[model samples]
Target: MSKALLVIDVQNEYFTGKLPIFNRDASLKNILKAIEYANTNGIKVILIKHIIPSPEAPVFAVHSYGAEIKQEVAEQPHNLIIEKHLPGSFTGTPLEEWLRSNQIDTLTICGYMTHMCCDTTSRQAVHLGFKVEFLSDATGTLDLSNKAGTIDANTLHETILIVQASRFADVLTTEAWCQL
Candidate 1:
């Protein structure tokens, strides 16, 4: 089976502006290692970029910066970039077709917002019949409020890891992922 590394939403917006609690350096290091490993081993690497609508405008307005993938993880020449508008990378995107065309059956995922984009994409990949290995430490998220109440960023991060481990994907640390 062909395997690929899916690097999701490692953008400047998450690192600098509004939601900025991300561990930029460490996540970059981990993703770089994974990228290098994939390059050396001939494993395909797909980079998923989330393009959220601009604030206070139409829900479909795409900001230029929000559409950019962070420089740190954008180094690979062979990497394929998939722009997504929804939380799930596969939603309304060519991700499934790309994976099919490339014959990718296993996906090693690492990127931003553990409880949102990353979580949604990982679960969607699983549902689409791909084996998913989620790099836990390489994904980060911010706090969110809902009817259940507010959840802190750190707690939400850990909760997603726990939830994904049980039902969605195999949650592995960067070290463990590298070993695979």
Candidate 2:
């Protein structure tokens, strides 16, 4: 079975400055390991970037600097870059076509905002009939606040990982992923 590594949204926004997550440096290290494994194993590495358009200037929206993939994860000519406007990488993107063209049946996904884009894309991948594997340690999110006050990002991240593991995909650590 053909397999691909989908590195989703390891962007500048989530790693540095105000929007930084709790344990970003460690997450980036894990993601880099996954990328290195894909590079050595001949697995296609597809990097997904999320673009959120500015509201005031709808037509000419300034791409959020944080939205850009972090320099650490930038393309190295051999990797393919896929731009996505929504939470799910496959939605409104050429990801499906590219996967079909490359005969990719299994996808290993790692990215930011564990409860949002990463989880959404993993579910969608399964729905679209692709075998999905999520890198547990390679994904993370910022703390979220609700009416009940703030929720720990790590708690939220692990909760979603459990949910996805129970229903959608095989959520594994970077080491487990490398073995695959």
Candidate 3:
């Protein structure tokens, strides 16, 4: 099966901007390892960037430092760089077409905000008929509190991994995924 590692939103926004991730160092380490493994194994790699087009955008403004991909991951060679404005990587983007064209049947997902972009992309990949492998430790999320009360980062991240494993994806740790 053809596989591609979709490195979603591994940008400075999560490191230095308004929203920061939980256990960031660990996640970054695993993701960097994953990228190296993929490159060595000849698997395709696509680095995704989420840009919030507004010039005054609080985060992810296009061409801004916040939206720039993490230098550790950015300096590495990749097959493609997709820019998106939504939670799902495929939404309003050439990601799906590119995947299909490249004959990628499986998507290995990792990067920021486990409960948001990672989950969204997983579900959408399943909906679009592509198999998904979600990296648990390679993904991270921050605590969230809103009208629906509060959810800690660990709870949110685990809950989404549970949801993904239930049907949408094959959820595994970074080590397990890398070994596969």
Cα RMSD (angstroms) for every candidate in the order listed:
2.3, 2.6, 0.7
C-alpha RMSD between model 3 and the true structure: 0.7
Candidate 3 contains a number of clashing pairs equal to 0
Predicted candidate 2 versus true structure: per-residue lDDT over 76-180, tens digit per residue:
433689887788999999899999999999998887889889999999999999999989999988899889888889899999999999989899999988876
> Which residue pairs come into collision in candidate 2?
13-66
Among all candidates shown, the one with the greatest TM-score: 3
Evaluation by TM-score, superior candidate among 1 and 2: 2
State each candidate's clash count: 1, 1, 0
Q: Which 10-residue window of candidate 1 scores lowest in summed lDDT?
A: 57-66
Question: Model 1, residue 176: what's the lDDT?
Answer: 86
TM-score each candidate.
0.89, 0.91, 0.98
For model 1, the stretches where C-alpha displacement exceeds 4 angstroms are 53-63, 146-148
lDDT (Cα atoms) of all candidates against the true structure: 0.81, 0.84, 0.94
Cα error of candidate 3 at position 38, Å: 0.4
Candidate 2 weakest lDDT stretch, 10 residues = 55-64
Report the lDDT tens digits of candidate 1 across residue range 88-169. Answer: 9999999899899988999888888888888898889899999988887787787788898998887988999999999888
Q: Per-residue CA lDDT of candidate 3, range 76-159, in tens?
A: 879999999999999999999999999999999999889999999999999999999999999999999999899999999999
Ranking by lDDT: 3, 2, 1
lDDT of prediction 3: 0.94
